[model samples]
Target: MLRPYREVLARPGALAFSSAGVLARLPMSMVGIAIVLAVPEVYGSYGLAGQITAVYVIVHSIAAPLLAHLVDRHGQARVMMPALRVAGLGIVGIILAIATAAHPGWVFAGAVVAGASIGSVGALVRARWSYILRDPAAIHTAYSLESALDEFVFIVGPVVATVLATSVAPTAGLWLPAAAVLLGGWMLLSQRATEPPVVRREAGASGGSSLRSGGMVVLTLVFAAVGSIFGATDVSTVAFADELGSKKAAGTVLAVFALGSMLSGLGYGLRHWQSPLWRRFAIGVVALACGVSLFFVVSSLPVLAAVMFVTGFTIAPTIVNGNGLVTSFVRPDQLTTGLAWVGTALGVGVSIGSAAAGAAVDQQGAHGGFLVVAASAAVAVVATFVALPTLRAGHAPAGRGAGPADYATVVPNSDPSA
Candidate 1:
């Protein structure tokens, strides 16, 4: 389990930056939990809060790529600091708006600004990994590590978010995430080791430029489905929990879902065997779809948790394979934009899923939300299966750039010794 990402595990700086990204992302859960708990608790209306949440998500969907492009054009450090400051101010503004019981319009506006400015450390850190890991084989391993990181963030972030929102004054808890994002992102900026975008120069040159390539399209779709699964399910679970008058279980349920993914990822990493990449990814999609549909049947928290756990199993491997395919076609230059595509897909999907599900559940109820989530997963499963035959199977190792750790040793080549 630890072996694939063993190298990242060894690097304090790499791990630190990754952790910083996690800390930066931690507020996502807090935002969701806070909106769900606080707005409803204060206003006595989940429906209104859900609508506001939808607007917040839409802002994130629109803004992620713009930020990523800036990161690519400027330095990640250069783009991140201002974003962090903006996001921080937005958080404070949100608290003040909510504290004063400001009009719903004010709350929605604040949320839009906050979500839009929420620095995309995920893109930056993954780009950084592309450089730090260096070799293709290591890159796959690094991708696996990143997949695990997402699962980890999903598991822990929500739990902490919920605890703070429910236990601490909602405003106090807000500061934790705001302060954390500033500290962590700034710390990452200070690190000279973080990777920047690769600039395309002639055929084999490097500098800094935003470029996109072949596998990126597929990656975006894959992440869109993955992100939708989480977003849809979070809302579905919330609707399901609400059916029984229990909202506290929302975070616990998500945490269990992450736990399942974590275990699967560990097992996936340890296995020397990986399926044909597309097939592996398709299988995960199908599994996720089936699992999402099963959420409709969950009537209680325990059953919901179990369903989430079971469904979570396929999350990491799908990401590992999807992103591994991305690295396969990405050029040395334009690496950040290539990666940004994946992040963009994720951002868009999450926003759509959350917003759609929130609205769906508000109007139609929990079962309807599950159906939507399942349908999204099914789209990936069916599309991937259709494309499966024409595409390659399994994650064959390939070197991304000039490096010792690249897939050179594993993938077939004319000079096996090269």
Candidate 2:
């Protein structure tokens, strides 16, 4: 299991980029909660904090693909470095506004600005791996590692943010993430050795709308539904802990969730499999729905934590396969943008889910949010099958139906010229 990852990281520049990527991506997990926690301290309302966080995510969903497109047309360091700086400044502005007791409106505006500028570093990290690792199996392991890193970041980020906010100051939460982004962004950009070369879109290679190509539209919708599970679960967990008179337990519970995901992701990468990508994706979706349903009945904290750990088992596999599907559907030059669309869809879903689940929590308590989780998973399951005809066309050439030796050369509809 570790052999593949070991070999891949042994490649020159891989460790540097991977380490930097982990640091940069850590902010993704921190910022939402940091804002949610910090804003309430100033405004005295979780409602305002939630709205600000929603604006941040919604704007990010809209802007990430555009920034990623620029990265594809230009270069990762060129585009991403400036984006990181702008994002840092926006966070600083928000901190300053909150310190000065500026209106919530200013905070919302700052969030939007930050959201627009914080590029999808996770997607770019995967794109870099796609460029550097040509072997299909190696790519699989690399993606799994990346997914595990995501789980790790989520585990670390919330705990760190919560600690800083509770033990230090509310401002510390946002300030620390800003500093993290700057440091990580600089480190990532400085390691120019592993960056993917810019692939300019040729004349007539505008390739129409990417959303129309190879069922990307359907896949993105699936991602949106899946993302809802994440958003609902996070908020519900915190609410659950609060109800139990142990608010800090929320972080530990959530960490269990991430632990399950991270371990499963690592286990998933340890071997290659012959199962069809879509089939595995379908199973993962079903498992997630069933797993999350367990939360609906749990009344005790121990039971909830255990259920959450088990429930997290399917997330990474689902995400890994979903990303694989994206790679098969777009041109190499469009990879970053294509991944960004999936991330955007997820972000949009997170905003929607968090808002809806928060309302549900207010009305019916934490467990009520489980309804949203199960429902969203069901929606994703439905979308997967509904999009099957289109996906079958797109996945056939490189997926289960293809010869093993063909895996390296198979492009599906990914190459516009082909």
Candidate 3:
């Protein structure tokens, strides 16, 4: 399990950028919880805090793909440095507003600005991997490791943010993430050697838009559904814990969820697959649906945690492979944007899921929200089947790039000694 990752990191400059990227992304998980804690503590209104966080998420989701498109056209360094700097300034302004008890409207606007300034750091990091490896066999390992790192980030980020806000200082959580955005982003931007080549748009090219590509819309919708499962499960888990008079159990149970995904991601990356991309995605969704459906039957916290652990087994493979599928269909010039769109779709889904889960938990109890997760996975499965023909058609006329049709076709050249 460790050997493959060690070999992948042995590539020139891989460790430096991957480490820096992880640092930059740690803030991605921190900011939400930090905002939920800080805004209410300072402003005395959870409503206002909720609104600020929602605006931040929506604006960031809308902005990420556009930022990635710019990163695609220009170089990563040129785009990332300015973007991270602006984001850092925005976060600082928000912190200052909180410290001084500025008007809620000013704070809200600052949050929007900060979110709009955030580049697609995770997608860009994955793009760097795609750029460096350039082989299907190698890229699979890279994506899996990246997904595992994501689990690790979410695991540590909330704990760090909460501890700093509660035990250290109310403003400490926000401050550290702001610093991370600046320092880590700057370090990542300094790595020029491994950056993806900027492919300028051809003069007469008609089809560069990833959104318009064949099956991409469906794929995006599937990713959105996947995101909803996460959102609904999170809120529902919190509600479950609250009902049990142990609100803090929310974090521990969620850690179980992350642990399940992290373990499975490591295992998934260590093997080579023989199925076609679409077929594997189909299998993944089915597995996800079956696993999440068990949530509807579990009644106790221990049972729920066990179900969550099982449910998590499907997430990493589904997401990692979905990303790989994007490489198969998108134009080389639009790879980063295409990948960013997946993140955007997930954001939108999470918002919808969170809202729906909140309403369900309020009206029907925590168990009600479990239905949403199962439904989401089922919906993704249906979308996969319905989109089969379009996906089989593969890349549109304009954006066809270099990806094998089947995973089995990827000749394994993973020399652990490399």
lDDT of 1 by residue, 1-418 (tens): 3666666557657877777777776676567656766786667798887777777667776677777666554566666788887887777777787778888777788788788888467667777787666555566666666677777876776566667777986555566767877787777767765545323234334343333333455557667877887778877887777787887667678789888888777667655444455566667777777887777766778988887788788788777766656655555334555666776677678767877787788788988898778777787676666656434532234534334223112121222221
Candidate 1: how many backbone clashes?
A: 10
Q: Residue 15, candidate 3: how far off, in angstroms?
A: 1.1
Name the regions of candidate 1 deviating beyond 4 angstroms: 1-4, 41-45, 103-105, 197-214, 245-247, 271-276, 297-301, 355-365, 389-418
The 10-residue segment with the lowest total lDDT in model 2: 399-408
TM-scores vs. true structure, each candidate: 0.83, 0.92, 0.93
Clashing residue pairs in candidate 2, if any?
Answer: none
C-alpha lDDT of residue 61 in model 3: 92
- Ten-residue region with minimum lDDT total, candidate 3: 406-415
RMSD of 2: 4.4
Q: Which ten residues in a row have the lowest lDDT in candidate 1?
A: 407-416
How many residue pairs clash (N, CA or C atoms closer than 3 angstroms) in each of the candidate models, in the order given?
A: 10, 0, 0
Please give the lDDT score for candidate 1.
0.68
